[model samples]
Target: MPRVSTDQLAARRQQILDGARACFARYGYEGATVRRLEQTTGLSRGAIFHHYRDKDALFLALAEQDAGRMADVVAEQGLVQVMRDLLAHPPATDPASADESSWLGTRLEISRRLRTEPEFRQRWSSHSAELTRATRERLERQRRAGTLRDDVPVAVLAQYLELVLEGLVSHLAMGLPADDLEPVLDLVEAGVRRR
Candidate 1:
């Protein structure tokens, strides 16, 4: 009956996204049922669905938020900084830190869904493209500035960086020791730097 202001609508949408992220992280995509989402968000199914058409849409929105954050990092600081950030605050195994590491959970879920769900894979392509585009644009800038190697094409370099990022995510997701990663990352940077 009453009109909600733009700020209120945005705030409510954010509330749903934040709560849905935690719910999906704590319990994988399949596990985050409507009831769990309701409990986690402290909002009714009607409210949550009002923001998102369904669980899949909610998950996609959450993933998009993470992807956008990553793309920003890639654009401004380079993909390696994204890795550094993840290492600085590695995925949390303990419940206390789980909220902080929700992004990792979303990433892990994305990987799983991409492999098993064709429809989700199709839906996710555009988001993945943004990251690739950011990586290429960063590489192009470095190339113009004489920082990146000239022999390899920017496309190749972007793919290399994307692969490296994926590997780093897998390593971190598996709970591998990240203490020795600084030098490893240095090696990655060196691989693309001008000789």
Candidate 2:
């Protein structure tokens, strides 16, 4: 083939990451091997190794990217702002796949890996804690603003919200027919209101 451009190289790398994401999602971190990644991407072993040092490197890269995205989504803004924005519009970011169940399958697989694999556990836990901290800060602001109730501790609620969001991700990934989450939002709005 003709020589590729920088853009081409970047795209190729993303393509490999995308392929690796799917592969890693299907197979656990330990179960997902470089050879399997090679076959999945249809790239030679050298090509795969050239892009990634090894399976741990590849898994870490994927985890970092995904965890960062999750954090961004969680602590995106103060709880009030996020709720207002979400209520104002449906989620702009749809799952990558049209098939709903497949989205959950991949996420569930990754979650499994995060729990079972020590390597994944450390990265995921760290990122999750970061998200909780950021969210707690935002929630504290909301509480001070008189928007959030005092019944629940900000830190506890932040962690609770994270868990709820994880479920939301699973629900959205599953691609159930009713994509609207207004009802869920309504419940949350009610629960957080000052008594």
Candidate 3:
């Protein structure tokens, strides 16, 4: 066998991570095994372990990467754009057609693992503070722009918004129609709307 180039190694590592994401989403963290990941990615056990120290390390890296991608997607779309898209397009019946569905599934799986796996939960909890801070900034921007209510505490409002968004994602993952989202969005908007 010839030596793999640096680029090839990086690409293979990324493929492994992508395959791991799919496996975790499909089977949850506990069900995702290195053997299964090898089958999914067609990589040898040696290659997998060479790239990632262990299953937990691989999962933590994937989870962090997924979370970062989600934040980037939201930022690129902007909050208003994301809200408009959610209100307009809705989720697809087919999972492959729905990016949000995949995201929600991944998030729910990670959340479940967080609850059941102490080490994973600790890693996730470290990221939560950063997520909350970003959310607080977004809410503050809306409030300062006079789009959201100024009466309530920004931190409190941010927490509520975060919970609402999480709930909406969970509902959507369960195949609830986008039409079902309007009332909840309306309630959130009403609570935060400028008087």
For each candidate in turn, the TM-score is 0.92, 0.63, 0.75
Better of 1 and 3 by lDDT: 1
Clash pairs (backbone) in predicted model 3: 149-192
Local distance difference test, candidate 3:
0.69
Determine which window of 10 residues in candidate 1 has minimal summed lDDT: 94-103
What is the full ranking by lDDT, best candidate first? 1, 3, 2
Worst 10 residues of 2 by lDDT: 95-104
lDDT, residue 106, model 1: 84
lDDT of each: 0.88, 0.62, 0.69
Cα displacement (angstroms), candidate 3, residue 146, comes to 2.6
Candidate 1 wrong stretches, greater than 4 Å: 95-97
- Please give, for residues 1-195, the per-residue lDDT of candidate 1 as tens digits: 999999999999999988888887777799899998998889999999998999999999999999999999999999988888878877767633466344677888999999999999999999999999999999999999999999999999998988988898899888899889999999998999999
Writing each residue's lDDT as its tens digit, candidate 3 over 1-195 gives 999999998898899888777666656677777787887668888988899999888888887776676555444433333454445645556534444334454677777777788977877887666566666677777778888787789888867777776777667657777776666676666787788
Per-prediction CA RMSD (Å): 1.6, 5.9, 3.9
lDDT of 1: 0.88
Return the TM-score for candidate 3, rounded to 2 decimals: 0.75
